[model samples]
Target: MTEHLGTDGKNHLQRLASLRRPLAAIALCCSVAVSLQGCVEMMVGGAVMGSLAATDRRTFGAQTEDKTIVFKGESRVSKLIGEAGHVNVNSFNRKVLLTGEVRDEAMKAAVEREINAIENVASVVNELEIAGVSSFSSRSNDTLITGKVKAAFVDAKDLFANSIKVVTERGNVYLMGLVTQTEGARAAEVTRNVGGVQKVIKVFDYITEDELRQLSTTQDKQTAR
Candidate 1:
């Protein structure tokens, strides 16, 4: 499926066109939910929701440069749905990845349809598993791992953790960051060594030396401050 998103341009367009309405519906439902729940609750909801949305964009863009182009197209369509802070969206080429909890099946299907409507989306990966809101302990674990992983990269020579985003869910570590081949190997090794990590899946975009240098500089500043 991912390979298709990378090589096949025509299929991507077909998928995006199919997804628009569903995604718009997701945005609508979220907007309504926030209005009913009030600002305080909405803010709390945004924290996790925002991460899911951002992770999708960051992960897909880092995975493939071609997919990044597809993502931009899909994002523009979603923007029209307005900024509903609850639902999260991710797209790679025409493959749309949806995650995070929603209130009902209608919302789920709506999001899936909207993503399918985009011009270049090859397919929609509807991983928006119906589940309750995230718990405090889960969020804390995510924060701890992100901070620790980013910190580890700072001290490790030639390794940049900022290029990697750490997502800890149910003790499993989902690593989404860009890195050079060597840096990725190092990051994987470090993740395995981390206590409480059930597993680490390396989802990274391998970059050239020049890109690595830029990332390294950015990482240095992050580590310093």
Candidate 2:
């Protein structure tokens, strides 16, 4: 049976289209994943993330550039830090967030510089701590905290959950999105209350509600045409 893809207004078809080039790679990985549960989990997670990316307000081109920025940034960080630090690189709409811990101020500065050098990186937020690297247990707990915040946002129902990206490091939660001021505040408020979060930081691109409405209308018109 042949599977046919169609647009359903919420970008489902777009996500499937974006997966075309990777279908071959994904097929190859299916065999390997059968032997490794971790590999299967990674593949499923990446696919889910890619599906979400297609629904992002940023242009598909911008989404691709954001992924490129993270990949290039991580490659450079590995060369710079090796076993000296633990850093997580996240790029949302081309704005890169640097989290985790480096050994010293010098290393933190170096990480920022290396990331800024990545093409299409509009800005870099260096939230990396200058202290001993986090333990594996700590990092794992941070990941759980991030998931909790995202799930909370979905349950809130007042905001488009996909509009925000959450990153957690050492219990600090960072939120990134292109949202209205009201939306940003609401998101921050909800995230701050999520269990295990130590702090909340908002890195949002604010626009008036009218502007957001106009953008949505324009997109609908474009899609209709």
Candidate 3:
């Protein structure tokens, strides 16, 4: 039997093929980690986190603060919008991105206000749509799409996959990162072609090429320590 796909389906399959190797590598690593002894597993986990932290553009304090912001912001949002909407909070370097759905415009604005009021939140990008909450299946699909985008990023040689934060809301991909203009654009370009990505939104804090060079140098020095 022969099956012919439409243009969109063919493109989607091509994109998925490109991501297979990297995603498989990730799966292999996870499996290996699971087979390790507890002490070895802990050490492996610590080393992985340390490597990510070393390469991260944010300062250690900023990284810590971002995690804090996400936790507190999500908690606050949950309390305020209880049963009114579905919200996901992602904070990178104190800037928060709000994605998902709300009951109405007022709820959307209120969510933003609540997120903005969180301690150490520098700014908020409110991308909440005024609609009924998304279903579990839709959210699961978004998660799968997000994973595919991230795997595609990992497969791209020119981009630092860890540098870009990917968030998906109803098939819309939002990229948050501290990257140079060229890097941000390249990241978006790569993301736009990925399977299941309906749109790519760049929510980036841009730096100069010189600044990027400095960051790379700093990361190398930290990693060599």
Specify the highest-lDDT model's number: 3
| lDDT of candidate 1 over 44-155, digit per residue (tens) | 8987765444433233443464365346634753563333323445543334455555556776687677667655565655655466656678768866875776676666
**TM-score of the candidate numbered 2?**
0.75
Identify the runs in model 3 with alpha carbons over 4 angstroms from their true place: 1-36
TM-scores, all candidates, are 0.44, 0.75, 0.82
- Tens-place lDDT per residue, model 2, 1-225, is 125533454477567778886997898799677878877889999989766754466777877898888888889999999999988999988899999888999999999999998899899988899888888899899989988998998899998888788888889899998799999999999988889999999887787989888767765665566
lDDT (CA) per prediction: 0.60, 0.86, 0.90
Candidate 3 lDDT over residue span 25-79, tens digit each: 9999998877776779789999999988877799889899999999998898899
Better of 2 and 3 by lDDT: 3
Cα shift from native, residue 162, model 2 (Å): 0.7
TM-score of 1: 0.44
* lDDT for residue 225 in candidate 1, whole number 0-100: 60
